[model samples]
Target: MATGGEAVARLDDGRVIFVQGALADEAVVVEITEAKKRFARGVAVAITERSAHR
Candidate 1:
C-alpha cells in the first residue's frame, strides 16, 4: 500500500501504477488517471480477484 492507501502495482511494461480503492494482493482492472515516466495513478475499475486480507 501507498501512504494514502492506494494499492501499488506494476504494468506489463513495468511502469508502477498507484491504484485507488484497491487492496494489496488483489487483482483489478485499472483505469489510469495520470501517467508519468516511472509511475502512474489509477483507479480500480473492476476487481478481478480479491485478497483474503479484505
Candidate 2:
C-alpha cells in the first residue's frame, strides 16, 4: 500500500510497483509492462484476494 492510499506495492528486489485498477488492500497478480531503476508500471491481471470493499 502507498502512503497516499493508492494500491501500490514493492517487489522483492525493492522496485516500487504501481498497480492500476487495483483496490486498496486487495491482493492481486500484476504484469509489469515497464521497468525502471526506481519504479515499475503495471496493471492488475488477477485479483487473488478481493478487498472487503469490493
Candidate 3:
C-alpha cells in the first residue's frame, strides 16, 4: 500500500488505527486497513507530508 501522510481512523467499535502513506491520504487503502481486526500501528518513519492537504 501507499500513502502520502499520516492518518488515524476510529472504527465503529472505537478501535483506533493509524497509517502513514500516500494511499491513506487519498483514502485508497481506507477499507484495506479495516479488513483485519488487529494490526500494528504505522509510524511515520520519514514523517513527510507528500500530500497537499498537509
Query: How many pairs collide in each candidate, listed in order?
Result: 0, 0, 7
On the 0 to 100 scale, the lDDT of residue 49 in model 2 is: 93
Q: Any residue pairs clashing in model 1, and if so which?
A: none
Across 1-54, the per-residue lDDT of candidate 3 in tens digits comes to: 425444666545666666655334444233343345664355444534355654
User: What TM-score fits each model?
Assistant: 0.92, 0.83, 0.32
Q: lDDT per residue, candidate 1, 1-54, as tens digits? A: 999999999999899999998999999999999999999999999999999987
Clashing pairs in 3: 2-22, 2-23, 3-21, 3-22, 3-23, 4-21, 4-22
Question: Which portions of model 3 show Cα errors greater than 4 Å?
Answer: 1-5, 22-25, 30-54
TM-score of 2: 0.83
Ranking by TM-score: 1, 2, 3
Instruction: In angstroms, give how far residue 54 of model 3 lies from its true place.
Output: 9.4
Q: List the lowest-lDDT window of 10 residues for candidate 3.
A: 25-34
User: Is 2 or 3 the stronger prediction by TM-score?
Assistant: 2
lDDT of 3 at 52: 60
